[model samples]
Target: MKTNANAIAFIMEGRRQRFRRWILVTGSLAALACMLCCAMLLLGNTIYPVQEVIRALMGEQVKGVSFAVNTIRLPRMLAGLFAGFAFGIAGNTFQTMLRNPLANPNVIGITAGSSAAAVFCIVILHTSNTVVSIASVIAGLATVLFIYVLSRGRSFSIGRLILVGIGIQAMLNAVISYLLLVGDQQDIPAALRWLSGSLNGSQMDDLPYLAITVLIFAPVILMLGKHLSILELGEQSATTLGVNADMTRIALIFSSVCMIALATATTGPIAFVAFLSGPIAKRLVGVGFSNALPAGLVGVNLVLAADLIGQFAFEVRYPVGIITGILGAPYLIYLLIRMNRKGSL
Candidate 1:
């Protein structure tokens, strides 16, 4: 009786620990995201005080502050925050599900698919933003399907999927380059800007759809967090645990793809926000905890922080994606070297 009681107490204690850890990590991330959002709104060309920024946000017509905060900064900040969250969640889902850090949407040709479609619309069709967004989402979904089908050889292989995705990304990038080379000079700049994953010129009108996508899909991912954790235990183990591994994976992939595609449409690819968020979140939260929300928050922080840096760090303004890419490349190289040494790749 005493042994059983002790086991029960131990299990209860573990649950309590996990719950506390979750709250701490998520709360910290939320606070950080909030701070960055405030900074984005307040620290522009003519830095407004927090009170003025708050007033502007509350629909007060505070002269200069209102116009700058509402018309310019608000939309940009919203786009970065939600899009970063989407990227972070989606990327972490892929990495966690596939058990490979290289399995991020950006690394695996999903964003390339969206970028290719958007570029095509800009360069060849002269399509509007709405059309570009629609085409990008469709292309992203199709790319995932193609990768899944091609990589399925009697069973799913993470190695095969990642390799095929990399190949597709290269091909799609070449296609984008070819289209640019043969297209009108006037459209090149617009296409290039989209490809670079920037948050500049983000408008209120463009934010609702992306926001809706995150709202609708993010919960689905979070709801399936338990299943996602199970998936990390490998397919056979998950199956042994009574988890529907295939269906759960498909559901996760679909939800993640939707979020990522919309996010890419909203702010291009945003460099490696997706790729870097998961590992960072895992490191911060440690093992034996769900890091989905934490990872999303990390992404939000990275995007907002990088945008601020790009805007004010240099004499010449750089895009958020450029800054993130600079930050991500070294990490990518380091990861590859470590993985090679471990013979894991």
Candidate 2:
């Protein structure tokens, strides 16, 4: 009877600790996201302060700040926030399911596929945002399908998938590089900017798709999240526990691809947020559990912070993606080395 009481007390304490951790991390990330949005809304070429930005948002006449903040940065900020959320969650899903930290959408060529297609459209076909979004989604799905088929031999294999994805990414990146080389010099800068990923010119029209995609998949991600956790305990063990291993994998891959594709479609595959968020989430929350919620929060924090840095960092502006890549690449290398050292790869 005493032991039972102690176990219950222990469980209650653990739950409370978890709740406190979640509230602290989630709350901090939320506040940071708000500040970043406001910073983006206010700081720009015309230089509106936060006060004016708020007044403008409140539907008052605030002169130069009003037009720029309302008509310009607000939409772009929201797109980045939502896109980051989608990438973070999707990336976490892949990593958790495969039990591999390198299984993120960006690392596995999904976003690269979308980027390659978008660059092709921009340089060759001169497609608008809508056309590019549609094309990117299709291309992302096709690329992942190719990788899956190439990797499959009656069962899923993590190493094969990662290798094939890296190969595909290299080839597509080469194509994009070649296109840049042969393109009109005038458009090359713009193309490079898009390739680097920026929320520079988003509009209200983009929001409908972004909103619809995240809203539809958020609940699905939550519902199936536990199965992903179960599937991490090896194939035989998961099957023994009555988890449909293959079906779970396919669903997770499909869901992750859709989320990443939709996000890249809207935001031009902002760099490293997808690749970086999962590991950070894992670190923050400790082990023995899924990292989806913290991953999504970290993603929001990364993009919001990067966007703010890019906007206000120095004398010159940098793209958000560039800043994240610069920061995330070294960490990725470290992760790879650690995996190799521990024989985890």
Candidate 3:
């Protein structure tokens, strides 16, 4: 009896320690994200003071500062914040639910769906941004349903889903390439910018849909985080634990698909933000609590910081996606190599 009590006490203490670490790690990441946001506002070409930036944000027109801060940087910052959060949360949700670090939206073709739709609108349809955004969302959801159906035969298989998603993504990429090859030269530049996952020219008007999508669906994913962790334990274990595996997975998939689609539409997929956010958050927050929130914060930090780096880190300005791709490619190669060595690929 005493040994059992001691074991229970030990488990309790470990939980407490994990909780503390989670709080500390999450808080630090949030603080860092906020700092990066501030830098985004203040460290542009002209470099406004913090007080002037705050005043401009507060509706006080301060000589040359208000337009720059409110018109240009504010929209850009908000885009990074909300879109990054969306990517981060959605990526973490998919990874956790699928129990595979490589199961992010980027890898499994959800973002590719959005990308293909947006590219089609830009290159072929000559549509407005609004049309592009709507088409992207519809296509994203459709892609999820399509992949789900194709992977659902003879019991759901993670490997099969991933394989199908990869194949679809390849086909979509070919379509995009064909469109670009035959698209108008004027339109090709626009399509290329969007395809490269840029944050250039982010407008205030383009944000509400993305913001609303993230606001509505992020909480849904967060609420299902416990079920996500359980789902990570395998379908049989999840079912034995009284979790409705199929329903929970569908809910998570739907929620994640929505946010990531909107985000991709908003910021052109912002390369690898979704892919890298989850593992970094998981590493930081350990295992006691859900890492969705931390993952989102990490994502915000990545996007905002990458934007800054792109803006100031070189003689020539690059897009946020370029910076992120530079950062993420190495990690991806490393992950693939490790998985290959373990025969988990």
Please provide TM-scores, in order, for all candidate models, with all chains considered together.
0.96, 0.91, 0.97
lDDT of 2 at 341: 100
Clashing pairs in 1: none
Whose TM-score is higher: candidate 2's or candidate 3's?
3
lDDT of 2: 0.81
Model 2, runs deviating above 4 Å: 45-51, 182-186
Write one digit per residue (lDDT tens) for candidate 2, span 217-296.
Answer: 76677777778888888889889989898888787777677778778877777888988888887777765455687788
Q: lDDT value for candidate 3?
A: 0.90
lDDT score, residue 125, model 2?
79
- Poorest stretch of ten by lDDT in candidate 3: 190-199
Model 3 TM-score relative to the real fold: 0.97
Candidate 1 regions off by >4 Å?
Answer: none
Tell me the deviation in Å of residue 165 in model 3: 1.2
- Residue 260, model 1: Cα distance from true site in angstroms: 0.8
Model 2 TM-score (2 dp)? 0.91
Residue pairs whose backbone atoms clash in candidate 3: none
Error of 2 at 89 (Å): 1.1
Q: What is the per-residue lDDT of model 1 for residues 1-345, given as tens digits with 9 covering 90 to 100?
A: 999999999998988887787788889989999999988998988998888889888988998999899989999999999999999999999999999999999889999998899888889999888888899899999999999899999988999999999999999999999999998999999778878989999999888889998999999999998889989989999999999998998899999998898888889889999999999999888767789989999999999999999999999999999999999999999999999999999
Query: Candidate 3 lDDT, tens digit per residue, 1-345?
Result: 999999999999999999999999989999999899899899888998889989999999899999999889999999999999999989888888887888888888889999999988888899888898899889999999998899989898887888889888898889889999988899998788878877888999999999999889988888988888898999999999999998998889888888888888888978899999999999889887899999999999999999999999899999999999999999999999998999987
